[model samples]
Target: MLKTTLGQWRMFRAVVEHGGFSQAGDAIHKSQSTIHHAVQKLEDSLGIKLLQVKGRKVGLTQAGELMLRRANYLLDEAAKLEAVATGLGAGTETQLKIAVDEVFPQNLLYRVLDTVSAQFPLLRIELMETVLSGAQELLEKARVDIALSPVPLANGFNEEFCQIEFLAVASPQHALHQQTQALSYEDLKSHRQIVVRDSASNSGKDVGWLGADQRWTVSHVRTSIDMISQGFGYAWLPVPAIEQELQSGLLKPLPLTQGVKRTAQLYLCFADGDRLGPAARTFIGEVRYQSESLLTAEQLSDSN
Candidate 1:
């Protein structure tokens, strides 16, 4: 028996990722037969089957799953080795990618970004503005180094960043507002509700009240806010994103008997929280600082 080569592992991982040999070949820019031969040679060297074909698609065998995990770790190590080598010479990353959920305060993030850019003038920044589970998905794919996600990050060091308050509101001119009586859950059920679609890759859910016979789904929270402000429907919107509307008397909180507002706790998460580059560390610190400031402001307001 011969030792398995890194090349085989690379091809195997590609096949599993792309879901088929032909797809993997297309991704790796190799002939399908060449890709198939490489994986076959790999199985022969290891004396085990790594994949099973199901119709036109391919699935990893139990052994393949374990091997794939190890391969990814090795690949990550290889990448880090290059990063370390480059850092010793360059002293900075060429680009820093960060993923953030819309649930998190955008203004605070902008402030943090401003600080990061001010300090690292030459370092390029990639901002991935995602919603719902999009941040988590980006993190899992190794697409971004840091993430501020609404959902719990499954594979990183995560800490509570801040809680955002959401107010259930509708246009002031909405029929629900015209009612002389307080709006109840039953009344809401009859009116249309604007709901933001969860951006999760799998098992994306519909959050909050859906009792309304009529529902409109939007990809982003701001879109939902726009729909609600237009008197098209009612929704639970983050208070910060609707502050102007609230102040201008365009959007008013639902006069619900209960559950007029809800708080969503967002987390600041990082895949390598401890080994973050200087740019990432600075950004995270600034983000945390701003988050604390927001919390303090909220507390003071509540006290008054």
Candidate 2:
């Protein structure tokens, strides 16, 4: 029976990518002798000559080429198995993998994490910040236990939680800030703006202030905030995301003659609602309970 395993497959792939044992060893941070021994053992176990050695160079034999293909497939399958096991183990610890919209506040997320961890010390928490579409994809694929997304639930996933307000923000120095009345949606057309691009291919519409010309379009909210902070352009940000900036006098809300407010519904989405574990249920509860109050307070402070 072949004694070859995933590690040997990695060694084989490395040698092929790097061209020789010495180069592969250097690339993988192993000694040349160790790589040579591993390949030899793998070949011996399989009873096949995998390499043709020439003066100072090595080439793959027909068997080696075939083995390389199989090795890659094996490695990919092994990686998938590892990911599944890790996710399962995490579930047992009351751990949850959550994908959130990029515009959500980092501190608010940490607060929820802290509360959960304090309540369940053994809980494992994994948070991924992505666009609403990506978050939706993670939920649909069952890769994440829960997702906090701005997009509503029309795409078929169940919504377990939601929030109902949005904020339009700009640098304090922006021309729109000089308007004496509440800002209208049409007023946004006059200013240059930065916007978050939907990462998922099927996301039909763009969120926020979109113009015919996009000087800066980014996939991350953090990058948009950074650019806005630098005065590159104005953007409509979630209230929770720009609370501190507004409070610090770094940003100001534009006033319009006709009030133009947007109500963004934040949803907690899951692939199979019936299959949610205790950890996922608890985390979802925490998020639902906290989102409204947190967003309201931040928005109130920003308006002040």
- The window of 10 residues in a row where model 2 has the poorest summed lDDT is 152-161
Poorly placed runs, candidate 2 (over 4 Å): 1-95, 152-157, 177-190, 201-204, 292-304
Best by TM-score: 1
Q: After superposing candidate 1, which stretches have Cα over 4 Å from the reference?
A: 15-26, 29-45, 49-66, 84-89, 201-203
Clashing pairs in 2: 181-256, 182-255, 182-256, 183-255, 183-256
What's model 2's overall lDDT? 0.74
Report the lDDT tens digits of candidate 2 across residue range 1-304.
5577778779878988888999999999999998899899888888999988867778899999998888877986676577567656656445578888876667767778888887778877888877867788777665787778876444446563555455666777777777776666676776778878886667755755465244577878778887887677777777667778879978766664543346666677765554566666777777766877776776898899
Give per-residue CA lDDT, model 1, range 1-304, as digits (tens). 5487777788889999999999999999988998999999989988999999888899989998898999988877777777666765776666789988887777888899999999999989999888877888888777888888888778678899788898999999999999999878999988998888777678567667789999988888889888888999999999989998999998999899999999988888877654467888888899989999988988999999
Residue 268 displacement in candidate 2 (angstroms): 1.3
Question: Which candidate leads in lDDT?
Answer: 1
TM-scores for all candidates: the values are 0.85, 0.60
